[model samples]
Target: MKKSLRFTKISVLLVAAISMSLTACGSTGPKGGAAPVQAGDESKLFGLSKTETPDELYEKAKKEGKVVVYSPSARANDAKKTFEAKYPGITVEVFKLKSNDLMDKLIKEQDAGLFNADVIITKEVSGAVGEEMVKPGRVYKYLPEDIAPNVDEPFRTKDGYANYLEMRTLYYNTEAYKSAPVSSWWDLTTPEWTGKVYLVDPLSSPAFMDLFTGMVVNSDDMKKAYKDKFGKEIELHGTENAGYEFIKRLRENKPVVLKGSGDVLDAIGKAGTKSQAVGVAVSGDERKIEDDGLKVAPIYDIKPKTSVPDAGYVYMAQKAPHEYAGKLFIRWMMGEKDGKGAGVEPFNELGSWVPRSDVKSKNAIPYEKLNMWTYEAKGFYTNSAKVRDFWIKLK
Candidate 1:
């Protein structure tokens, strides 16, 4: 009887060992899935969909009651009023900020696990946005089924929807020059335009960083434009590439770094102001020509691309309290069914380009005819810090 019992114990031990070995051989992963390191399935939380109609979301959102947003647009208040008007029960609480400030606040809130915002609509500081938010599963993408067809494929990122387009553009004083005094980007680096060029602080402004980082990423284009302008290959100094070289030279020449866009405009746009000053981007446009009596005009014809495509993107918060309401607000803000939705009317202004093909820009420049590079998050992410360091060390 003792021997039989010992054999039974041995048999059970052998079976258990075999089962453990088989389990190890069958799985190479910790959780034993094909995609082990990817972000978890957040679709259930975000409720992402193309087919989910406004009516469907509205029913759920009405129950959810209110939506909160963090956006950079001055017109966000107008959008809030319009959205509240459209949906009787749903109220909007708006937190307007510049792109950088918005990112900072969102990151702080996310770090503290304070998920108060339902939506975030900021101008694209693509690299920072992707690195800080999207990759961490802090935000999720959803474009409405009704509006998806009209938006171009490139604008529809897996991370978010590009709702509109703006630029990292250069402007020349019409009061100073009969036409653009400088024809190429390199022209700003030369002695002739030195002290005449005005710019916002690159270190502080996300938009300027986007521009400088873009120039670095498209260094090849900068080289080509340099050769076109100078009729020789670009001679890189301590800088690594033509883009960096251009930035260094522009800095050496002392582009008057100002505190605000209004300051740059006042320098370049005041009527009969004969400074011949060219200003780096700060969001002023030719509508100033009509309304503010400023004579600034965009340099659309400059080489190495017309402008950096600084897109305005809308994203749903990953852990939103009012998920349905958030999605509803994004759809409404994206100019709803016909691109004639009331939510977009507030944002329709000169220099801003809507993503929907049907929605026309108030700017006079032909969209297709303009040459500009698409916003590249990875490229900017890879090099923005290096560019920032270079800018600071030089400064």
Candidate 2:
């Protein structure tokens, strides 16, 4: 009865929110191109119209007066400080949430027609809730058009509403498995590496979840190849029974699940050369792992265990109280370094792919550009609920 009542309340809330957003005006339109401000020209940025420059859109960002963000990373505070320091007048509110929570909140808010957030930096929840929400291109668009062009095609929308930027890379402790032949992502699932494997819970870490989702969705070729090699069908998607059996076997591999990527990183850090657990890690954390003198390397094998590109994106709420601020934030996000985030090089990071080409890549894997892996974007986004339920059943 309690569960039923709770559900009823949630339904009421959702209905109220959706009605609010639908009534808001100009919430679902696109913006025209801004005049190009070459890198290093802050003057043009100051005088341009909101149509031409993110700066013009948010000339009062400092006065309007706060920017709220929801991110999958625990480092939200650090990122906020970096941005606030660069733009002194604007106060930043940061929420470090699991990807699931990020998606739940975003979707619920969108459904309710509330625009409480100015910007959102999330992990790969795009798979789970992307389809239920607004189309990224129809609602929010890309920034720094020239620069964004260099980001990988898979990471962004063709219309440029969503732009995927590099955030981090995955790393394994090299010294821990020095004697063993461990060079690829598939190696972690092997018997020899069984007890030694550690990973983040998919519900908690968007980066790790997206990475794994990428693996599952991209394993189509492998499934076909397995069937071809054995001269029989390798059932990747079969009746419910077959899928459940596969998932059960996957769980039997006995991965040590932590709440977040940082937990795995902590264990790696403490272990030094003697670390027994090898884990999936953020590129930034991996650099720290290596810098601490522990031998760690990023596994970038493109076949079988092909890596997925890490990307960042933002969306505008359909019913935003601060609609102008939300659009301004998206434009600001796309602005070159001089415009946003403390010259953090605007959208390019290590081991990830952005749309632009000339900008230096931080941690992109070679041969990754090859479409050897069959990544199902549509499948992941639409079927995430089923996948999450399955993962829970296995647990």
C-alpha RMSD for every candidate: 12.8, 8.1
Q: Model 2, 1-395: lDDT tens per residue?
A: 11111223354446435433221112232232123334554323221222434465467564577767777654446545555665666666767766557667765675575656655665445343333333221123333433444344543333223333433234565666564345444445457767777777877544555555554555554454344444676554442533343344446789787777667766654654567666766554545654555565655543344445454545554434444455555544444533333333434444434344444446544323533333344556644455566677677
lDDT of 1 at 31: 21
| 312: Cα error in model 2, Å | 2.7
lDDT tens readout by residue for model 1, 1-395 = 11111223354446435432121011111122111122443332222354667889899899989998999886778888989998999999999987767887876787797878888887766376754555445565666556766765465434456676667677877767788777788988888877988888877666677788888899999999999998999999988998999899988998899986667777888887776788876543445556788888877777878777777778776567787888788888888878988888766677777766778778676455557877766577667778878988997
TM-score of model number 2: 0.65
lDDT of each: 0.71, 0.48
* Lowest-sum lDDT 10-residue window in model 2: 1-10
